[model samples]
Target: MVEPLPHVREIPPYVPGKPPPARPGLTSYKLSSNENPYPPLPGVLAAAEQAVASMNRYPDMGCALLYDALAAKLGVQVDQLAAGTGSVALIYHLLSAYCGPGDEVVHAWRSFEAYPIAVTAAGAAGVKVPVTADGRHDLDAMAAAITERTKVVLVCTPNNPTGPALTHAEVATFVAAVPAHVVVVVDEAYLEFVRMADPVDGLALVRDHANVVLLRTFSKAYGLAGLRVGYAVAAPEIAGALRAVALPFGVSSVAQAAAVASLAAEDELLARVDGLVAERARMVAGITAAGWWVPEPQGNFVWLGVGDRAAELAAAAGDVGLALRPFAGEGVRVSVGEAEATDRLLHLLGSLEPPS
Candidate 1:
């Protein structure tokens, strides 16, 4: 009989949002995952196709061209950047690099579900600081919770599940208070979708704080989710440490080509993000008018804090053939999808008589 480690036994597996089935109906649209409802840009697709032709040869292990491109785009030294299969993978790498038994990683509870899983996987204790009642990070509480054992602090602006984002001033205050030795990762997967005034810029924080790292992804705004590519920008030493633990050739040639192309076509891609931002605003305004009090969402998703009624809300959504992300006993998260999908969800939501 095999005995798994005690920490391994305590870890909960990460659960992804339900996938939409291929049902032929208007109500069957999937709003479960916070995925962009658009396809890859034409130039990006062409680049990916071109790379596929070279499948016979191995991808560049050093990712030299990608480094150069990112450096030129970001105006940072090439040594300050590191690429991974996904931002999720980069998170895991960060955990593995800095955490071990007896160490602790701090992050907001009910934030990204991956945080706890990755922390436990690294044999570290997860210190979950609960968010404020309005679904924003309780920064002061988090700063107070920090101890000598804390190795990392994860701040997810435009946080998942519940969509309130940290303002630039809010983030600045938190970073200034954190210890210099502790790594602070600002996960900006949904950064491009943010429309708030004075939004936190992770890149700016990274430039100012030696221990700060910015985790950005192609999966969200760039619409390269299928290709699985993300990157981190940090001090050269931290970037080197991350690269040290990363799996070799994890960023495939195809993914690299697609990412470079996406960067080249970023202006047009961001215009599509503007459309999603509008859709999110529509969802919020439409639902608020229906008497529901939702936290103002800055990401491409909306949160319904149904509390213990989570399962019921999810089931009701399912009845309409709408797949929503529901956190049982907590709340529901519905993404802004295609126009028809948005119409169906908003119509269903508006028809309900809930407390303001």
Candidate 2:
């Protein structure tokens, strides 16, 4: 019998959010994946289409043009960047480069599910610090969890599943307290949606700290979820290590073209984010007036702490041909979709009876 490694056997598979269920007559909306509801911005789709002609050729392994453009935009050196299939892929690459058996990766519990998956795959022990009551990272606890065995510390601002973000002062304090040897990865996957007061500037943190890495993706705000592409901004040495583990030709030419176009159309694309922000506020307001307790959301999604009724809560949304993300007994994450989805969800979610 072929047996896998112990760590490999232990890892729970990474499950992408369930797709929108079929509705015979009524229009259904999927608010499960925290996906940006909008389509590609002007020029973005066209750039992607144009790149189709080059499908016969392999993608630029170094991602030269993308690096040049992103470097100029983020005000970072080209060598300080490494593109990957997605930020999650980059997360895995980070672990692959730095972690092995007996090493540890520190992150918050009930945060991004990908963190634990990657750590397990790398044969690294995961130290999961629980979040505060309101769905915010307990930075103090995370710092306390660190030890000589810790190789990476992941900070997910505007934390997934539950959408509260960390303030600048909070992250600064945590960053200062953490040791220099451990790589602190600030995953800013949905930072474009954050509008909280005193927001953490991830790039600035990376610029100042040699051990800091800011992992961001075009999947959310850029509306490029279908075409996988994300990048890490870090000190050249760290960036080089990430590149060392990256799958060659991992980022396709189409994705590269689309990302460059999205940057060129940044103003217009961000305007769409403004619309989503407004919709998010509307979602929070509607959910609150109905009597359920939800944490203030800074991302393009809202988290309902449904606890044991998570499946029941998701079923209620499903009844209206709307799909939501449920973490069993934890909570439900509803993405900010079109106005109708929000309107219907508010009306339906309030009516869901708690499961005994």
Candidate 3:
């Protein structure tokens, strides 16, 4: 039997949020993945369906229409954008382009699970900086963790699984502190859901600093998770490098068409995002009113730092026909799903003792 590289052998597999199990007499909701509960808009769905008619033909390698739509929407040059199967894939591409064996990638732990996976896959060492007790990234600590070997630094605003988002001033100051040679990646997969004051202007960061890259996805807000459309905005030089390493025709024609249609109907799609934001507020309020302390959530999910009770709470949710993501010995991440799901979760939490 052939053996894989030692680095690949040691890499931990990514665990995605699971779907709810079937129940005999109850409705089940999958709130484990931080996904948009709403279905795609009629226009977006139609665009995807139309694209499906040409299934025999290969997709455009350059993703021309998608790039055009994105450039117009973001006010960025076409050469400065690189699209991929998902933002997660783009992460891998950027890391592969910049990092080699012994190079370091600094990121907040308990943040996006993909960071370490992608970092390790690029044959780079991951410098895991622990997040704050409030589930926010310790930007100062992250900056201090940087070394001469550091090549890439990731900042996940409204971080996944965790709930807190970094403020503009906070990230801007941190960016200024880092050396100019290191690449700063602002992973804004949850940007559309953020409702906080002084949110980080990722595009501005990219404009001001050639080393900064902004990663955005259509999955969370545009209800395009299944389509797997995401893009990165960077200086043309970095963007070109990412594009160079990207998988050929990684994004399918259907996905491109759906993404373009979604952009054209951004107003309607964002309205759905507004609904999820309101639902997130409701979940936070209910949890707080019940005397439970959770990090202030700005994304479409809430973090319950239940420590050892994480698995226990997740099991209870599963028993009630709801699925939630849990990190053993840490906490459970509950995505703000349908109203019924939120109500069911609140009822379950109210019945149990809050985590100490």
* Top candidate (TM-score): 3
- lDDT (C-alpha) at residue 215 in model 3: 96
Q: Residues 91-187, candidate 1, lDDT per residue (tens digit)?
A: 9999999999999999998899999999999999999999888898899999998999999999998899899999999999999999999999999
Reference-based lDDT, each prediction: 0.89, 0.90, 0.93
Residue pairs with backbone overlap in model 3: none
TM-scores of the candidates in the order shown: 0.97, 0.98, 0.99
Model 1, position 205: C-alpha lDDT score: 92
Question: Could you give the C-alpha RMSD of every candidate to the true structure, in order shown?
Answer: 1.4, 1.3, 0.7
Worst 10 residues of 3 by lDDT: 17-26
User: Residue-wise lDDT of candidate 3 within 115-173, one digit each (tens)?
Assistant: 98999999999999999989999999999999999999999999888889999999999
Model 3 residue 156 CA deviation in Å = 0.3
| Best first by TM-score, ranked | 3, 2, 1
- The whole-model C-alpha lDDT of candidate 3 against the native structure comes to 0.93
Model 2: which residue pairs collide?
none
Worst 10-residue lDDT window, candidate 1: 20-29
Model 3 regions more than 4 Å off: none
Q: 293, model 2: CA deviation in Å?
A: 1.4
